[model samples]
Target: MNWLNKLERKFGRFAIHNLTMYLIGGYVIGYGIYYLMPNLLNWLTLEPGMILHGQVWRIVSWVLIPPSGNILTIIIMMMLYYSLGNALERTWGAFRYNVYIFSGILFTVIGAFILYFITGGFIGLGIFFSTYYINMSIFLAFAASYPDMELLLYFILPIKIKWMALVYAVMILYTMVRGNIAVRVAIVASLLNFVIFFFSSRNMKPYSPKERARKTKFKQQSRPHMTYPGGARHRCAVCGRTELDDPTLEFRFCSKCNGNYEYCQDHLFTHQHVK
Candidate 1:
């Protein structure tokens, strides 16, 4: 997680904002390609065996494979994934969201190659390694972040996200049991990011904006007031402003400073530390 933070600080600007649009667009283009030239998908799928035989483009082109052939199914899939992806982006920021998605893709690619090697390059896992599980990962993350959020199941019964996630979990387990080696690999690889993120962030709580604001307000109110020589309390050491001067100014003690020095939010990260 520290490494992720470092990477975000260095490459956050390069993250694609609103990445869900591109994913949906890819599916649209894939569907068009599927309808026009169905055989072309054979060359575009993730076939490591074929890649060794001079079709290297298959590595990236595999993403062009539509998850389903049914029009209605694809439409619903796109809409559901788009909403989940957008919500995750807003919750985790663009960089982390990019990492989650890109990592899933990377893992899927790795799994394909591993399967190819294990099976002696005889098996082609293109069909198994679709964006279906990647999209499922997004839903799992959204459910974890907003467990209490409800949605209409088939536009009739209201259900919580946690319940949906649980159902998906059972489905994945069923697939792993009944599916072939390639199918199991695909499912695990695509959802690996979700597993990694859930464990890595076990200590951290995902809070909604309102809940975050409430927590901040509570902390501010409960902070012990520091008394100064002139009977001043809640003062910023750098700005030399007390709560009496500006009642709205929040103060926090700097852990890096040698002594007990407080700073306002504006100067908390920018002010020089005491020796």
Candidate 2:
């Protein structure tokens, strides 16, 4: 993590702010091309054979090939991942988040080249590589960051994110087991960031549950409650309590809520939705 800190000090200026917008924009462009001139996507895929044949743009253009889905599915996926990516960026900071995402993309590219050479350059795996599993890694990272956070299952029954993370992990495992070599490589390479970033974090051992609890308790007691000039920085939509009322309270905006409504930890899961 210190290495990440050092890298951040050196290259943090180039980190993209709100990177999810560009990612979704790429998808929108891909979808537009898919509907209009479908043949053009062939030139944009990550085909190592094409790259070797001097179509070097394929190396970067492949990212514009959006995940396979209908319009509605694409819209929902974009919106959901946009929120998740932003949350992760906020949680981990832009530099580290950029590293996580770009590393996934880099690994995917490397894996494609390895697979191409392994198969003696006979098969082109352009269709195999996409941002689908990389996006899944983002979802996994969000779940890990807010494990206790709850989401509505189909806009009704509330479920904790940790459970969904578990389900997603199983689903990925199943896909890998049943998929071809190309699919296997794509999935593994895209998700390697999770193993490297999340595990290598300080949360692995020194910040065990008990240790984290102790630190949290110490900070809460020592921190002073401050008042804002206009209004409170954080106010729960349910209880309406601010940091001025209790500096200890952790406030978070509920992603499932219709509007920009926030809640304190006490009411985050139990409060009724606006819609």
Candidate whose lDDT is highest:
1
Candidate 1: 10-residue stretch with minimal lDDT: 202-211
Which 10 consecutive positions of candidate 2 have the poorest summed lDDT? 222-231
lDDT of 2 by residue, 94-205 (tens): 7778899999999989989988997889556887898889999998988877789898887799999999999999999999999999889989888999989787677443
Q: Estimate each model's TM-score.
A: 0.78, 0.74
Off by over 4 Å in 2: 202-275
RMSD of each: 7.6, 12.9
> How does candidate 2 fare on TM-score?
0.74
What lDDT tens digits, residue by residue, belong to model 1 across residues 176-270?
99999989989989999999998766443543535656777777875554566566777788888887787788889899998778898889999
Indicate the residue-level lDDT of 38 in model 2: 97
Estimate the TM-score for candidate 1: 0.78
In candidate 2, the residue pairs with backbone N, CA or C atoms under 3 Å apart (3 or more residues apart, or in different chains) clash, namely: none
